[model samples]
Target: MLDFFIQPFFEFAFMKRALVACFALALGSAPIGVILMLRRMSLFGEAMSHAILPGAATGFLIAGFSLPAISIGGVIAGLVVVLAAGAATRATDQREDASVAAFYLIALALGVALISMRGSSVDVMHILFGSVLAVDEAALLLLGVVSSVSLALLAALYRPLLLDGFDPDFLRSLRGTGGGTLYHLIFLGLVVVNLVAAFQALGTLMAVGLMMLPAVTARFWARSLPGMMAVAALIAAVSGYAGLLLSFHANLPSGPAIVLACGAFYILSLFFGRVQGILLRLLPTRHLEA
Candidate 1:
Protein backbone atom coordinates (compact mmCIF):
# COMPACT_ATOMS: atom_id res chain seq x y z
CA MET A 1 0.00 0.00 0.00
CA LEU A 2 2.86 2.37 0.75
CA ASP A 3 4.40 1.47 -2.59
CA PHE A 4 1.02 1.94 -4.22
CA PHE A 5 0.85 5.44 -2.73
CA ILE A 6 4.50 6.34 -3.29
CA GLN A 7 5.91 4.59 -6.36
CA PRO A 8 4.48 6.50 -9.30
CA PHE A 9 5.28 9.91 -7.90
CA PHE A 10 8.74 8.72 -6.90
CA GLU A 11 9.47 7.20 -10.31
CA PHE A 12 7.90 9.60 -12.79
CA ALA A 13 9.03 13.19 -13.39
CA PHE A 14 5.75 14.25 -14.94
CA MET A 15 3.87 12.88 -11.94
CA LYS A 16 6.06 14.92 -9.65
CA ARG A 17 5.39 18.03 -11.70
CA ALA A 18 1.69 17.29 -11.72
CA LEU A 19 1.69 16.92 -7.95
CA VAL A 20 3.48 20.23 -7.44
CA ALA A 21 1.18 22.01 -9.86
CA CYS A 22 -1.89 20.63 -8.14
CA PHE A 23 -0.71 21.65 -4.67
CA ALA A 24 0.22 25.12 -5.85
CA LEU A 25 -3.18 25.43 -7.44
CA ALA A 26 -4.85 24.24 -4.27
CA LEU A 27 -2.85 26.60 -2.10
CA GLY A 28 -3.69 29.62 -4.20
CA SER A 29 -7.19 29.06 -5.49
CA ALA A 30 -8.97 27.42 -2.55
CA PRO A 31 -8.85 30.48 -0.30
CA ILE A 32 -10.12 32.72 -3.06
CA GLY A 33 -13.02 30.35 -3.58
CA VAL A 34 -13.79 30.47 0.13
CA ILE A 35 -13.94 34.24 0.07
CA LEU A 36 -16.00 34.23 -3.07
CA MET A 37 -18.39 31.72 -1.57
CA LEU A 38 -18.67 33.91 1.53
CA ARG A 39 -19.58 36.81 -0.69
CA ARG A 40 -22.12 34.62 -2.49
CA MET A 41 -20.31 34.98 -5.80
CA SER A 42 -19.69 31.36 -6.69
CA LEU A 43 -21.69 31.60 -9.89
CA PHE A 44 -19.93 34.83 -10.84
CA GLY A 45 -16.60 33.18 -10.13
CA GLU A 46 -17.60 30.28 -12.37
CA ALA A 47 -18.54 32.73 -15.09
CA MET A 48 -15.22 34.48 -14.62
CA SER A 49 -13.49 31.14 -15.07
CA HIS A 50 -15.02 30.85 -18.54
CA ALA A 51 -14.34 34.52 -19.03
CA ILE A 52 -10.58 33.89 -19.16
CA LEU A 53 -10.90 31.55 -22.13
CA PRO A 54 -11.18 34.10 -24.91
CA GLY A 55 -7.83 35.59 -24.02
CA ALA A 56 -6.31 32.15 -23.54
CA ALA A 57 -7.70 31.11 -26.92
CA THR A 58 -6.36 34.28 -28.43
CA GLY A 59 -2.99 33.60 -26.86
CA PHE A 60 -3.07 30.07 -28.26
CA LEU A 61 -4.04 31.44 -31.63
CA ILE A 62 -1.14 33.85 -31.76
CA ALA A 63 1.53 32.00 -29.79
CA GLY A 64 0.70 28.32 -30.11
CA PHE A 65 0.47 27.49 -26.41
CA SER A 66 3.43 29.52 -25.21
CA LEU A 67 3.14 30.03 -21.47
CA PRO A 68 3.66 33.78 -21.31
CA ALA A 69 1.27 34.56 -24.12
CA ILE A 70 -1.49 32.40 -22.76
CA SER A 71 -1.17 33.68 -19.22
CA ILE A 72 -1.05 37.28 -20.36
CA GLY A 73 -4.03 36.86 -22.62
CA GLY A 74 -6.02 35.20 -19.87
CA VAL A 75 -5.20 37.92 -17.37
CA ILE A 76 -6.11 40.63 -19.84
CA ALA A 77 -9.37 38.96 -20.74
CA GLY A 78 -10.32 38.47 -17.11
CA LEU A 79 -9.53 42.06 -16.23
CA VAL A 80 -11.70 43.27 -19.07
CA VAL A 81 -14.65 41.30 -17.81
CA VAL A 82 -14.15 42.36 -14.19
CA LEU A 83 -13.67 46.01 -15.02
CA ALA A 84 -16.61 46.00 -17.39
CA ALA A 85 -18.80 44.28 -14.86
CA GLY A 86 -17.77 46.66 -12.13
CA ALA A 87 -18.53 49.68 -14.27
CA ALA A 88 -21.82 48.32 -15.54
CA THR A 89 -23.00 47.45 -12.07
CA ARG A 90 -22.04 50.87 -10.79
CA ALA A 91 -23.53 52.87 -13.62
CA THR A 92 -26.83 51.17 -14.17
CA ASP A 93 -29.68 49.71 -12.13
CA GLN A 94 -28.63 46.28 -13.41
CA ARG A 95 -27.40 43.85 -10.82
CA GLU A 96 -23.75 42.77 -10.90
CA ASP A 97 -24.87 39.18 -11.39
CA ALA A 98 -26.67 40.00 -14.59
CA SER A 99 -23.81 42.08 -15.93
CA VAL A 100 -21.24 39.46 -15.06
CA ALA A 101 -23.33 36.79 -16.75
CA ALA A 102 -23.57 38.81 -19.94
CA PHE A 103 -19.80 39.29 -20.10
CA TYR A 104 -19.08 35.63 -19.46
CA LEU A 105 -21.34 34.52 -22.29
CA ILE A 106 -19.72 36.91 -24.70
CA ALA A 107 -16.26 35.80 -23.64
CA LEU A 108 -17.14 32.10 -23.96
CA ALA A 109 -18.47 32.51 -27.48
CA LEU A 110 -15.46 34.53 -28.54
CA GLY A 111 -13.11 31.97 -27.04
CA VAL A 112 -14.81 29.15 -28.92
CA ALA A 113 -14.70 31.04 -32.18
CA LEU A 114 -11.05 31.92 -31.72
CA ILE A 115 -10.02 28.36 -30.94
CA SER A 116 -11.90 26.97 -33.94
CA MET A 117 -10.04 29.24 -36.30
CA ARG A 118 -6.65 28.53 -34.74
CA GLY A 119 -6.46 24.77 -34.33
CA SER A 120 -8.26 21.45 -34.33
CA SER A 121 -11.28 20.48 -32.24
CA VAL A 122 -8.74 18.79 -30.01
CA ASP A 123 -7.22 22.16 -29.20
CA VAL A 124 -10.56 23.52 -28.04
CA MET A 125 -11.09 20.40 -25.95
CA HIS A 126 -7.65 20.82 -24.48
CA ILE A 127 -8.52 24.40 -23.57
CA LEU A 128 -11.61 23.11 -21.83
CA PHE A 129 -10.38 19.79 -20.33
CA GLY A 130 -6.62 20.41 -19.70
CA SER A 131 -3.67 18.01 -19.34
CA VAL A 132 -2.27 18.14 -15.82
CA LEU A 133 0.09 15.18 -16.28
CA ALA A 134 1.77 17.12 -19.03
CA VAL A 135 2.54 20.20 -16.89
CA ASP A 136 6.15 21.19 -17.60
CA GLU A 137 8.76 23.27 -15.76
CA ALA A 138 7.60 26.56 -17.29
CA ALA A 139 4.02 25.85 -16.32
CA LEU A 140 5.09 24.87 -12.82
CA LEU A 141 7.08 28.08 -12.50
CA LEU A 142 4.06 30.10 -13.58
CA LEU A 143 1.91 28.35 -11.02
CA GLY A 144 4.45 29.00 -8.29
CA VAL A 145 4.71 32.69 -9.13
CA VAL A 146 0.99 33.16 -9.23
CA SER A 147 0.57 31.29 -5.94
CA SER A 148 3.16 33.43 -4.22
CA VAL A 149 1.64 36.67 -5.47
CA SER A 150 -1.89 35.62 -4.58
CA LEU A 151 -0.99 34.52 -1.05
CA ALA A 152 0.99 37.68 -0.43
CA LEU A 153 -1.82 39.92 -1.58
CA LEU A 154 -4.35 37.90 0.36
CA ALA A 155 -2.41 38.43 3.56
CA ALA A 156 -2.02 42.15 2.88
CA LEU A 157 -5.68 42.71 2.21
CA TYR A 158 -7.05 40.28 4.76
CA ARG A 159 -8.75 42.75 7.06
CA PRO A 160 -10.36 44.85 4.35
CA LEU A 161 -11.45 41.84 2.37
CA LEU A 162 -12.87 40.17 5.44
CA LEU A 163 -14.95 43.20 6.27
CA ASP A 164 -16.06 43.37 2.68
CA GLY A 165 -16.98 39.72 2.72
CA PHE A 166 -19.29 39.88 5.73
CA ASP A 167 -20.40 43.48 6.01
CA PRO A 168 -19.90 44.88 2.56
CA ASP A 169 -22.63 47.48 2.78
CA PHE A 170 -21.14 48.86 5.97
CA LEU A 171 -17.65 48.63 4.50
CA ARG A 172 -18.81 50.67 1.53
CA SER A 173 -20.23 53.34 3.81
CA LEU A 174 -16.94 53.61 5.69
CA ARG A 175 -14.53 53.61 2.75
CA GLY A 176 -16.41 56.25 0.74
CA THR A 177 -15.85 57.25 -2.96
CA GLY A 178 -17.41 54.07 -4.30
CA GLY A 179 -15.97 52.16 -1.34
CA GLY A 180 -13.01 49.82 -1.67
CA THR A 181 -12.80 49.84 -5.43
CA LEU A 182 -9.03 49.42 -5.29
CA TYR A 183 -9.25 46.53 -2.90
CA HIS A 184 -11.99 45.02 -4.98
CA LEU A 185 -9.79 45.35 -8.05
CA ILE A 186 -6.98 43.69 -6.17
CA PHE A 187 -9.36 40.90 -5.26
CA LEU A 188 -10.42 40.44 -8.85
CA GLY A 189 -6.79 40.57 -9.94
CA LEU A 190 -5.92 37.74 -7.60
CA VAL A 191 -8.84 35.72 -8.89
CA VAL A 192 -7.71 36.16 -12.48
CA VAL A 193 -4.10 35.38 -11.67
CA ASN A 194 -5.13 32.18 -9.96
CA LEU A 195 -7.42 31.33 -12.84
CA VAL A 196 -4.62 31.83 -15.37
CA ALA A 197 -2.32 29.61 -13.35
CA ALA A 198 -5.05 26.98 -13.03
CA PHE A 199 -5.72 27.27 -16.74
CA GLN A 200 -2.33 25.70 -17.39
CA ALA A 201 -2.88 22.69 -15.16
CA LEU A 202 -6.66 22.23 -15.36
CA GLY A 203 -7.98 24.52 -18.12
CA THR A 204 -10.75 27.06 -17.69
CA LEU A 205 -13.62 24.62 -17.14
CA MET A 206 -11.87 22.24 -14.73
CA ALA A 207 -9.91 24.94 -12.91
CA VAL A 208 -12.80 26.13 -10.76
CA GLY A 209 -13.42 22.57 -9.62
CA LEU A 210 -10.36 22.65 -7.44
CA MET A 211 -11.11 26.16 -6.22
CA MET A 212 -14.81 25.75 -5.36
CA LEU A 213 -15.30 22.15 -4.21
CA PRO A 214 -12.83 22.35 -1.35
CA ALA A 215 -14.40 25.60 -0.19
CA VAL A 216 -17.89 24.13 -0.19
CA THR A 217 -16.57 21.05 1.57
CA ALA A 218 -14.88 23.19 4.20
CA ARG A 219 -18.12 25.00 4.89
CA PHE A 220 -19.70 21.72 6.03
CA TRP A 221 -17.09 21.26 8.76
CA ALA A 222 -15.85 24.68 9.77
CA ARG A 223 -17.48 27.41 11.87
CA SER A 224 -15.06 30.32 11.54
CA LEU A 225 -13.55 31.89 8.44
CA PRO A 226 -10.00 30.90 9.29
CA GLY A 227 -11.06 27.37 10.11
CA MET A 228 -12.78 27.05 6.77
CA MET A 229 -9.71 28.28 4.89
CA ALA A 230 -7.39 25.93 6.73
CA VAL A 231 -9.67 22.94 6.30
CA ALA A 232 -10.23 23.74 2.66
CA ALA A 233 -6.51 23.92 1.97
CA LEU A 234 -5.91 20.58 3.67
CA ILE A 235 -8.75 18.99 1.76
CA ALA A 236 -7.41 20.38 -1.50
CA ALA A 237 -3.90 19.08 -0.84
CA VAL A 238 -5.20 15.62 0.08
CA SER A 239 -7.40 15.60 -2.98
CA GLY A 240 -4.39 16.38 -5.17
CA TYR A 241 -2.28 13.58 -3.70
CA ALA A 242 -5.07 11.02 -3.84
CA GLY A 243 -6.16 12.08 -7.29
CA LEU A 244 -2.66 11.67 -8.65
CA LEU A 245 -2.54 8.15 -7.27
CA LEU A 246 -5.89 7.36 -8.88
CA SER A 247 -4.76 8.86 -12.16
CA PHE A 248 -1.68 6.62 -12.15
CA HIS A 249 -3.55 3.45 -11.20
CA ALA A 250 -6.79 3.98 -13.08
CA ASN A 251 -5.39 5.70 -16.20
CA LEU A 252 -7.65 8.65 -15.58
CA PRO A 253 -7.08 12.25 -16.57
CA SER A 254 -5.29 14.00 -13.74
CA GLY A 255 -7.30 17.24 -13.72
CA PRO A 256 -10.73 15.65 -13.64
CA ALA A 257 -9.55 12.93 -11.30
CA ILE A 258 -8.46 15.52 -8.78
CA VAL A 259 -11.81 17.28 -9.12
CA LEU A 260 -13.69 14.00 -8.67
CA ALA A 261 -11.65 13.35 -5.57
CA CYS A 262 -12.84 16.72 -4.25
CA GLY A 263 -16.40 15.75 -5.13
CA ALA A 264 -16.02 12.50 -3.20
CA PHE A 265 -14.93 14.40 -0.13
CA TYR A 266 -17.83 16.77 -0.63
CA ILE A 267 -20.39 13.97 -0.80
CA LEU A 268 -18.98 12.30 2.28
CA SER A 269 -18.90 15.57 4.15
CA LEU A 270 -22.45 16.36 3.15
CA PHE A 271 -23.62 13.29 5.01
CA PHE A 272 -20.92 12.91 7.67
CA GLY A 273 -19.22 16.23 8.34
CA ARG A 274 -18.79 17.37 11.93
CA VAL A 275 -20.48 20.74 11.80
CA GLN A 276 -23.33 20.51 9.33
CA GLY A 277 -23.38 16.92 8.18
CA ILE A 278 -26.74 15.23 7.68
CA LEU A 279 -25.71 12.61 10.23
CA LEU A 280 -25.65 15.31 12.89
CA ARG A 281 -29.29 16.05 12.15
CA LEU A 282 -30.09 12.35 12.50
CA LEU A 283 -28.43 12.33 15.92
CA PRO A 284 -31.03 14.81 17.21
CA THR A 285 -33.88 12.82 15.70
CA ARG A 286 -32.59 9.62 17.31
CA HIS A 287 -32.23 11.39 20.65
CA LEU A 288 -35.86 12.64 20.52
CA GLU A 289 -37.11 9.15 19.66
CA ALA A 290 -35.10 7.67 22.57
Candidate 2:
Protein backbone atom coordinates (compact mmCIF):
# COMPACT_ATOMS: atom_id res chain seq x y z
CA MET A 1 0.00 0.00 0.00
CA LEU A 2 2.81 2.37 0.85
CA ASP A 3 4.59 1.50 -2.38
CA PHE A 4 1.36 1.97 -4.28
CA PHE A 5 0.85 5.36 -2.66
CA ILE A 6 4.44 6.50 -3.27
CA GLN A 7 4.62 5.25 -6.83
CA PRO A 8 2.46 7.91 -8.47
CA PHE A 9 4.52 10.77 -7.05
CA PHE A 10 7.73 9.11 -8.25
CA GLU A 11 6.50 7.83 -11.60
CA PHE A 12 4.32 10.52 -13.12
CA ALA A 13 4.76 14.21 -13.79
CA PHE A 14 1.03 14.58 -14.31
CA MET A 15 0.33 13.08 -10.90
CA LYS A 16 2.76 15.52 -9.36
CA ARG A 17 1.00 18.35 -11.10
CA ALA A 18 -2.35 17.00 -9.93
CA LEU A 19 -1.17 16.97 -6.33
CA VAL A 20 0.30 20.47 -6.57
CA ALA A 21 -2.78 21.88 -8.27
CA CYS A 22 -5.04 20.34 -5.66
CA PHE A 23 -2.90 21.75 -2.87
CA ALA A 24 -3.05 25.19 -4.40
CA LEU A 25 -6.80 24.89 -4.92
CA ALA A 26 -7.35 23.71 -1.36
CA LEU A 27 -5.47 26.73 -0.05
CA GLY A 28 -7.05 29.21 -2.44
CA SER A 29 -10.67 28.18 -2.33
CA ALA A 30 -11.21 27.22 1.30
CA PRO A 31 -10.72 30.67 2.88
CA ILE A 32 -12.56 32.41 0.09
CA GLY A 33 -15.38 29.91 0.42
CA VAL A 34 -15.66 30.56 4.15
CA ILE A 35 -15.97 34.27 3.43
CA LEU A 36 -18.49 33.63 0.71
CA MET A 37 -20.63 31.51 3.04
CA LEU A 38 -20.44 34.15 5.74
CA ARG A 39 -21.41 36.94 3.34
CA ARG A 40 -24.34 34.93 1.95
CA MET A 41 -22.62 34.72 -1.41
CA SER A 42 -22.38 30.92 -1.50
CA LEU A 43 -25.09 30.89 -4.14
CA PHE A 44 -23.15 33.42 -6.11
CA GLY A 45 -20.23 31.03 -6.30
CA GLU A 46 -22.56 28.33 -7.56
CA ALA A 47 -24.00 30.82 -10.04
CA MET A 48 -20.58 31.81 -11.31
CA SER A 49 -19.60 28.15 -11.73
CA HIS A 50 -22.50 27.59 -14.09
CA ALA A 51 -22.30 31.03 -15.65
CA ILE A 52 -18.74 30.56 -16.97
CA LEU A 53 -19.60 27.66 -19.24
CA PRO A 54 -20.43 29.84 -22.21
CA GLY A 55 -17.12 31.62 -21.93
CA ALA A 56 -15.28 28.31 -21.69
CA ALA A 57 -17.03 27.08 -24.81
CA THR A 58 -16.22 30.25 -26.66
CA GLY A 59 -12.62 30.00 -25.58
CA PHE A 60 -12.43 26.41 -26.78
CA LEU A 61 -13.79 27.46 -30.13
CA ILE A 62 -11.32 30.29 -30.48
CA ALA A 63 -8.14 28.89 -28.96
CA GLY A 64 -8.56 25.14 -29.27
CA PHE A 65 -8.14 24.14 -25.65
CA SER A 66 -5.85 26.97 -24.64
CA LEU A 67 -6.01 27.17 -20.86
CA PRO A 68 -5.33 30.89 -20.55
CA ALA A 69 -7.79 31.78 -23.25
CA ILE A 70 -10.52 29.63 -21.74
CA SER A 71 -9.81 31.00 -18.30
CA ILE A 72 -9.94 34.60 -19.50
CA GLY A 73 -13.17 34.01 -21.37
CA GLY A 74 -14.70 32.40 -18.30
CA VAL A 75 -13.61 35.33 -16.16
CA ILE A 76 -15.14 37.79 -18.60
CA ALA A 77 -18.38 35.88 -18.70
CA GLY A 78 -18.41 35.79 -14.91
CA LEU A 79 -18.02 39.56 -14.74
CA VAL A 80 -20.82 40.00 -17.25
CA VAL A 81 -23.11 37.80 -15.21
CA VAL A 82 -22.38 39.77 -12.06
CA LEU A 83 -22.95 43.10 -13.80
CA ALA A 84 -26.09 41.93 -15.50
CA ALA A 85 -27.47 40.41 -12.32
CA GLY A 86 -26.76 43.59 -10.38
CA ALA A 87 -28.39 45.73 -13.06
CA ALA A 88 -31.42 43.51 -13.27
CA THR A 89 -31.85 43.64 -9.53
CA ARG A 90 -31.71 47.44 -9.58
CA ALA A 91 -33.94 47.92 -12.61
CA THR A 92 -36.72 45.49 -11.75
CA ASP A 93 -36.48 45.01 -7.99
CA GLN A 94 -36.12 41.30 -8.64
CA ARG A 95 -34.34 39.15 -6.13
CA GLU A 96 -30.65 38.55 -6.76
CA ASP A 97 -31.14 34.79 -6.49
CA ALA A 98 -33.69 34.75 -9.27
CA SER A 99 -31.37 36.64 -11.55
CA VAL A 100 -28.53 34.31 -10.68
CA ALA A 101 -30.56 31.21 -11.43
CA ALA A 102 -31.69 32.60 -14.74
CA PHE A 103 -28.17 33.50 -15.75
CA TYR A 104 -26.82 30.11 -14.67
CA LEU A 105 -29.39 28.18 -16.67
CA ILE A 106 -28.95 30.31 -19.76
CA ALA A 107 -25.20 30.18 -19.68
CA LEU A 108 -25.09 26.41 -19.12
CA ALA A 109 -27.38 25.75 -22.07
CA LEU A 110 -25.43 28.09 -24.31
CA GLY A 111 -22.15 26.55 -23.29
CA VAL A 112 -23.36 23.08 -24.11
CA ALA A 113 -24.70 24.22 -27.46
CA LEU A 114 -21.43 25.90 -28.40
CA ILE A 115 -19.33 22.93 -27.36
CA SER A 116 -21.53 20.58 -29.32
CA MET A 117 -21.28 22.75 -32.36
CA ARG A 118 -17.51 22.71 -32.21
CA GLY A 119 -16.52 19.41 -30.58
CA SER A 120 -17.78 15.90 -30.05
CA SER A 121 -19.89 14.76 -27.10
CA VAL A 122 -16.83 13.00 -25.69
CA ASP A 123 -15.09 16.39 -25.41
CA VAL A 124 -18.13 17.83 -23.69
CA MET A 125 -18.10 14.98 -21.15
CA HIS A 126 -14.42 15.60 -20.54
CA ILE A 127 -15.09 19.30 -19.99
CA LEU A 128 -17.97 18.66 -17.63
CA PHE A 129 -16.18 15.86 -15.72
CA GLY A 130 -12.57 17.07 -16.11
CA SER A 131 -9.22 15.35 -16.62
CA VAL A 132 -7.40 15.98 -13.38
CA LEU A 133 -5.04 13.05 -13.81
CA ALA A 134 -3.64 14.72 -16.90
CA VAL A 135 -2.88 18.13 -15.36
CA ASP A 136 0.40 19.53 -16.75
CA GLU A 137 3.29 21.53 -15.29
CA ALA A 138 2.10 24.74 -16.95
CA ALA A 139 -1.32 24.32 -15.39
CA LEU A 140 0.27 23.72 -12.00
CA LEU A 141 2.30 26.92 -12.37
CA LEU A 142 -0.82 28.85 -13.33
CA LEU A 143 -2.64 27.44 -10.32
CA GLY A 144 0.23 28.41 -8.05
CA VAL A 145 0.35 31.98 -9.31
CA VAL A 146 -3.39 32.48 -9.08
CA SER A 147 -3.60 30.89 -5.63
CA SER A 148 -0.75 33.01 -4.31
CA VAL A 149 -2.23 36.25 -5.61
CA SER A 150 -5.68 35.35 -4.29
CA LEU A 151 -4.35 34.49 -0.86
CA ALA A 152 -2.42 37.76 -0.76
CA LEU A 153 -5.50 39.73 -1.77
CA LEU A 154 -7.59 37.97 0.85
CA ALA A 155 -5.03 38.74 3.51
CA ALA A 156 -4.88 42.41 2.49
CA LEU A 157 -8.64 42.78 2.58
CA TYR A 158 -9.21 40.60 5.60
CA ARG A 159 -10.62 43.22 7.94
CA PRO A 160 -12.89 44.95 5.47
CA LEU A 161 -14.09 41.71 3.98
CA LEU A 162 -14.92 40.32 7.40
CA LEU A 163 -16.71 43.49 8.32
CA ASP A 164 -18.73 43.33 5.16
CA GLY A 165 -19.42 39.66 5.68
CA PHE A 166 -20.65 39.96 9.23
CA ASP A 167 -22.53 43.23 9.05
CA PRO A 168 -22.97 44.81 5.67
CA ASP A 169 -25.67 47.09 7.03
CA PHE A 170 -23.36 48.50 9.69
CA LEU A 171 -20.56 48.98 7.15
CA ARG A 172 -22.90 50.67 4.73
CA SER A 173 -24.29 52.99 7.41
CA LEU A 174 -20.80 53.97 8.53
CA ARG A 175 -19.70 54.85 5.04
CA GLY A 176 -21.47 57.55 3.03
CA THR A 177 -21.34 55.63 -0.20
CA GLY A 178 -21.74 51.87 -0.79
CA GLY A 179 -18.54 51.38 1.18
CA GLY A 180 -16.90 50.43 -2.09
CA THR A 181 -19.15 47.49 -2.71
CA LEU A 182 -17.57 47.36 -6.09
CA TYR A 183 -14.57 45.80 -4.48
CA HIS A 184 -16.72 42.89 -3.44
CA LEU A 185 -17.82 42.53 -7.03
CA ILE A 186 -14.23 42.41 -8.17
CA PHE A 187 -13.37 39.87 -5.50
CA LEU A 188 -16.17 37.68 -6.73
CA GLY A 189 -14.85 38.05 -10.27
CA LEU A 190 -11.49 36.79 -9.08
CA VAL A 191 -13.23 33.83 -7.45
CA VAL A 192 -14.78 33.00 -10.79
CA VAL A 193 -11.41 33.17 -12.47
CA ASN A 194 -9.97 30.75 -9.94
CA LEU A 195 -12.92 28.46 -10.43
CA VAL A 196 -12.39 28.47 -14.18
CA ALA A 197 -8.73 27.73 -13.78
CA ALA A 198 -9.61 24.87 -11.51
CA PHE A 199 -12.35 23.59 -13.79
CA GLN A 200 -10.00 21.71 -16.06
CA ALA A 201 -8.86 19.69 -13.07
CA LEU A 202 -11.99 19.55 -10.91
CA GLY A 203 -14.82 20.17 -13.32
CA THR A 204 -17.53 22.80 -12.88
CA LEU A 205 -19.85 20.90 -10.53
CA MET A 206 -17.22 19.17 -8.44
CA ALA A 207 -15.19 22.37 -8.29
CA VAL A 208 -18.16 24.06 -6.66
CA GLY A 209 -18.45 21.15 -4.24
CA LEU A 210 -14.76 21.32 -3.36
CA MET A 211 -14.93 25.07 -2.81
CA MET A 212 -17.96 24.87 -0.53
CA LEU A 213 -17.93 21.55 1.30
CA PRO A 214 -14.75 21.89 3.31
CA ALA A 215 -15.65 25.38 4.41
CA VAL A 216 -19.13 24.32 5.39
CA THR A 217 -17.83 21.43 7.40
CA ALA A 218 -15.21 23.57 9.09
CA ARG A 219 -17.88 25.98 10.23
CA PHE A 220 -19.24 23.30 12.51
CA TRP A 221 -15.91 23.04 14.34
CA ALA A 222 -14.62 26.60 14.62
CA ARG A 223 -15.92 29.67 16.40
CA SER A 224 -13.62 32.24 14.80
CA LEU A 225 -13.14 33.11 11.16
CA PRO A 226 -9.41 32.40 11.20
CA GLY A 227 -9.96 29.07 12.88
CA MET A 228 -12.58 28.18 10.32
CA MET A 229 -10.31 29.03 7.43
CA ALA A 230 -7.46 27.02 8.89
CA VAL A 231 -9.64 24.00 9.57
CA ALA A 232 -11.19 24.22 6.13
CA ALA A 233 -7.82 24.31 4.44
CA LEU A 234 -6.60 21.37 6.45
CA ILE A 235 -9.65 19.31 5.59
CA ALA A 236 -9.38 20.19 1.93
CA ALA A 237 -5.71 19.30 1.75
CA VAL A 238 -6.17 16.00 3.49
CA SER A 239 -9.15 15.12 1.38
CA GLY A 240 -7.29 15.96 -1.80
CA TYR A 241 -4.42 13.69 -0.91
CA ALA A 242 -6.63 10.85 0.20
CA GLY A 243 -8.86 11.19 -2.84
CA LEU A 244 -5.95 11.10 -5.23
CA LEU A 245 -4.62 7.98 -3.57
CA LEU A 246 -8.01 6.34 -3.77
CA SER A 247 -8.39 7.27 -7.41
CA PHE A 248 -4.96 5.97 -8.28
CA HIS A 249 -5.61 2.72 -6.50
CA ALA A 250 -9.16 2.16 -7.63
CA ASN A 251 -8.83 3.57 -11.11
CA LEU A 252 -11.61 6.10 -10.58
CA PRO A 253 -11.95 9.64 -11.79
CA SER A 254 -9.75 11.90 -9.70
CA GLY A 255 -12.07 14.89 -9.58
CA PRO A 256 -15.14 12.96 -8.55
CA ALA A 257 -13.23 10.87 -6.07
CA ILE A 258 -11.82 14.00 -4.46
CA VAL A 259 -15.25 15.53 -4.24
CA LEU A 260 -16.62 12.34 -2.70
CA ALA A 261 -13.89 12.41 -0.10
CA CYS A 262 -14.77 16.00 0.72
CA GLY A 263 -18.39 15.00 0.98
CA ALA A 264 -17.47 12.26 3.44
CA PHE A 265 -15.78 14.83 5.63
CA TYR A 266 -18.86 17.00 5.50
CA ILE A 267 -20.99 14.11 6.64
CA LEU A 268 -18.55 13.25 9.39
CA SER A 269 -18.54 16.84 10.56
CA LEU A 270 -22.30 16.83 10.77
CA PHE A 271 -22.23 13.94 13.20
CA PHE A 272 -18.99 14.65 15.07
CA GLY A 273 -18.33 18.38 15.04
CA ARG A 274 -17.68 19.93 18.42
CA VAL A 275 -19.90 22.95 18.01
CA GLN A 276 -22.83 21.54 16.13
CA GLY A 277 -22.87 17.79 16.29
CA ILE A 278 -25.96 15.62 16.53
CA LEU A 279 -24.78 14.54 19.98
CA LEU A 280 -24.68 18.16 21.09
CA ARG A 281 -28.12 18.75 19.68
CA LEU A 282 -29.52 15.83 21.65
CA LEU A 283 -28.11 16.93 24.97
CA PRO A 284 -30.56 18.10 27.63
CA THR A 285 -31.39 21.81 27.77
CA ARG A 286 -30.73 23.64 31.04
CA HIS A 287 -33.51 25.64 32.69
CA LEU A 288 -33.16 28.57 35.09
CA GLU A 289 -35.78 28.84 37.83
CA ALA A 290 -37.22 32.31 38.32
After TM-score superposition, the amount by which residue 175's alpha carbon in candidate 2 deviates from its true location, in angstroms, is 4.0
Model 2 error, position 242 (Å)? 1.3
> Model 2, 123-142: lDDT tens per residue?
79877878788788777888
Residue 246 C-alpha lDDT in model 1: 91
RMSD of each: 2.2, 2.2
Residue 168's C-alpha lDDT in candidate 2?
70
Lowest summed lDDT window (length 10), candidate 2: 281-290
Residue pairs in clash, model 1: none
When summed lDDT is taken over every stretch of 10 residues in candidate 1, the lowest stretch is 281-290
User: How do all models score by TM-score?
Assistant: 0.95, 0.94
Cα lDDT over the full model 1? 0.90
Question: Which residue pairs in candidate 2 have backbone atoms (N, alpha carbon, C) closer than 3 angstroms, thus clashing?
Answer: none
